[model samples]
Target: MADELIFYTHPQSRGRIARWALEEVGAAYETQVVEYGTTMKGEDYLGINPMGKVPAIVHKGRVVTECAAICAYLAEAFPEAGLAPTAEERADYYRWLFFAAGPVEQAVTNNFAKFEPSADQGRMFGYGNYDLAVDVLEKAVSAHPYIAGDRFTAADIYVGSAVGWGTMFGTLPKRDAFLDYFSRLSSREAYQRAGAKDDALAAELEAAKAPA
Candidate 1:
């Protein structure tokens, strides 16, 4: 179909974030599960995403990779879902959205890998340092009901996923602000539905690998 939205993801990867966003926007998309290191790196899949990453969406024949971009694109594409931000909310929406995608993601991954940069190196990095990046993120979440202000927007999908996975996986500190922020987001019906779908797919994959 000309308007088909094809979602490429792995149940165990950050694709969960994009899945949630898709559910939020109520987009009718077809899911394609890609395994790590095998089909994910294969020529066919790599042709879709040169980076060989999951959570990519091909909508209306246009490819959108990166969880943040997917969320933003879906929101705009499905305005009836009201996931897009208003003019007043635009500043915080883009600010915190990219902040999570850039600084927070970099800081958390570097911290998890135990690669602390020196002061000089920190200056060269966009995140500065994990501690600084995390501290700023905590304040951002606590300042408002949602990342983009009082209303829920696509920005929350990206930022909330970071906070949710970070705290759950021990990559981020179990701060009250982080926990509270994620708690609110996790309660959304869309989030629950998306999670259930992914969990089921994960179980199927595991079962297929089990000895018959």
Candidate 2:
């Protein structure tokens, strides 16, 4: 179909976020698993995303990359899913959505790599410092039932995935607020479904790599 949505991802990456968002929006998408350093960087896949990364989607011949952008794009593209923000929810939606994508993502990755910014360098970095960025994120999740407002939206999928994965991997601190937020998201039927699909695929990939 001309409007078919094709999702390219690897089971073990941030692609899980995009998959969860797809499940939430209830979009029928075909998944293409690309191996890192191989098909992911090969000409065909790279043509879709020069970044040579997973978690990209092609819909109606238009490509969307980055998990956050994919979530936002899907929400708007399928408005019937009701994941898109309302006029009142727009501010908080975009605010925390980009906040998680930018500051939270940077802070968590830097912390994991043991790269702490000096006070002077902190001023230059967008997140200021890992500790400060996490503290702010804690407040954001605690302030609302969901990331954007009282209800679940596309923003939650991205922000919740960050918190969920961070806490799971020990990249982000296991604060009560962060734990509570992700707990709520993880219980969602769509989140569970997405997780099952990815987990099964991950197991299959691991099995293929094992000695036969």
Candidate 3:
């Protein structure tokens, strides 16, 4: 039970974010890729994540779920990684981390599904509206090199993935700020290593499914 983390993920899911965080932690980990509609929702996996979601991790037999939560948990679980925020930067760190997980995520999901909340219900929704949520995120990233400040932290990994994926998929606008931030985050060595492994896994899965 010495620093053993079992990572449950699918190559094409939000597991990507967890993978990046895992790399950053530099902890000994074993990844189990859950196949969609199969092991993903299997009893074994479901027991670990009742929601049957990928990107869940079991460290020392404790389960952690959700992309953002897993990333935050990993930072604390492996403090030597220096991914957690300093006491002085905790506010900014928690603020934007949850902001991205909630508002930014809501905006992107709504856009992708083409679902619009009634205009009158804007006040009821955390994001208010897609454009407003995006604008707020834009301003946040634009104002700071890293989400919590000049230093890179787990918050950046989580938010950076949102901005990176949103921009690539056109769910969120590709503003200059988002592009620059994503570029910087994507250039990190850990990010690249995680991405390569996931990309290879995705390609292998695709190949396996191809008609011979």
Writing each residue's lDDT as its tens digit, candidate 3 over 13-106 gives 9999999999999998998889989998899999999898888999988999999999899999899999999998899999999999998888
Query: Which ten contiguous residues of candidate 2 have the minimum total lDDT?
Result: 1-10
Tens-place lDDT digits, model 2, residues 51-97: 99989999988999999999999999999999999999999999999
- TM-scores for every candidate against the unseen true structure: 0.97, 0.97, 0.96
Worst 10-residue lDDT window, candidate 3: 1-10
- After superposing candidate 3, which stretches have Cα over 4 Å from the reference? 1-3
lDDT of each: 0.93, 0.94, 0.92
Runs of candidate 1 with Cα error greater than 4 angstroms are 1-3
Strongest candidate by lDDT: 2
Model 3: residue 100 alpha-carbon error in angstroms: 0.6
Candidate 3 global lDDT: 0.92
- In candidate 3, which residue pairs clash? none
Span of 10 residues, lowest total lDDT, candidate 1: 1-10
How do the residues 46-92 of candidate 1 rate in per-residue lDDT, one tens digit apiece? 99999999979999888999999999999999999999999989999
Ranked candidates (TM-score, high to low)? 1, 2, 3
Error of 2 at 111 (Å): 1.4
